[model samples]
Target: MRHGKTFGLSLFLLAAGTGGALAQATVVTPLQQQYITAYVAQNPVPAATYGSEFDPTVGAVVPETVVLNQFAVRQEENRNWDGGQDAVRSMLYFVTPTQQTVLVEPGTRRVVYVMR
Candidate 1:
């Protein structure tokens, strides 16, 4: 038990040290904030209802190939390739409020991605 505790502490410290090195504070101007707000508003999370309904294990899988395939499908559908072009028809990975990784459709805000 003691050894496990020590190992955990060491791992924590190592992670903390690394993260600290990359940590920097940034101040966003009012203009920047407004742009972000407008963007968020236009892309309103249609799937907000699925915000916390994701399976805890959903995020554990390797999403590389699947995610790429989805992206390709979207890109093919709309050659110009905008976020809304993909809309809410495809699957996407997202972090739930509970910190669980869940699959969702960002536009329509559904959890159907996980079950698929």
Candidate 2:
């Protein structure tokens, strides 16, 4: 009976941890997508050339060697453009060779959004 209780508690803890991560995940709306696309278009950067093995997707970790740039706009402008979401404003960005704009979380270097 004690072993059963321990297992149940362990499962509950694991679910709670996973739920927290899911809650923190970003959900880009169509309006936000348009904003991102326009922002990238207005401030062009040279596309990065990573090997074929380095395909970037949402939630993928970008390599440390790859250069990431902050959004070119001023903080106030960025806040307005990103709908005042600090999470969106704080992301680092890079252009992929295929013309996709990838937004990465600064701390994790993980791709949060890939705007095609």
Candidate 3:
């Protein structure tokens, strides 16, 4: 009998095409657990971003209002959503040494106290 690679190939393709859904990678550690905790405490969502780590001895103190302002500014820059539904909470950020500022929305995931 002649060997038939064609039939095997078709069967493989059909099985692969309609066989199963792709599996997702499992996360062993908790995901954004701290941020969730902070959100409940903060109440109003703040525009939060991950920034470069700063030295604690630098004598830089981040205020609450400033964070909110950053949130507002960033939202404006990104043109975040129109209103309702996709609407996101405003937020802000101020880096003292660089004297740079950024604004963004916290979206649905708000953080209370962003800390180490």
lDDT, each prediction? 0.32, 0.64, 0.28
Candidate that beats the other on lDDT, 1 or 3, i.e. the better one: 1
Q: Return the lDDT, model 2, position 56.
A: 90
> What lDDT tens digits, residue by residue, belong to model 1 across residues 7-103?
3343333335443222121122333233333433444342222323333341133333222112223334456433332222233444333433334
Q: Write the per-residue lDDT of candidate 2 for residues 61-99, one digit (tens) a residue.
A: 789888898865566675465342344455688998888
Higher lDDT: candidate 2 or 3? 2
**Structural similarity to truth (TM-score) of each candidate:** 0.24, 0.67, 0.18
lDDT agreement of model 1 with the native:
0.32
Give RMSD (Å) of candidate 2 vs. truth: 10.8
| Candidate 3 local Cα displacement, residue 56, angstroms | 6.7
| Ranking of all candidate structures by their lDDT, best first | 2, 1, 3
Candidate 3 error regions (>4 Å): 1-68, 71-89, 102-116
Candidate 1 regions exceeding 4 Å error are 1-18, 21-24, 46-116
- Give the count of colliding residue pairs in each prediction: 3, 0, 12
- As for TM-score, the candidate ahead, 2 or 3, is 2
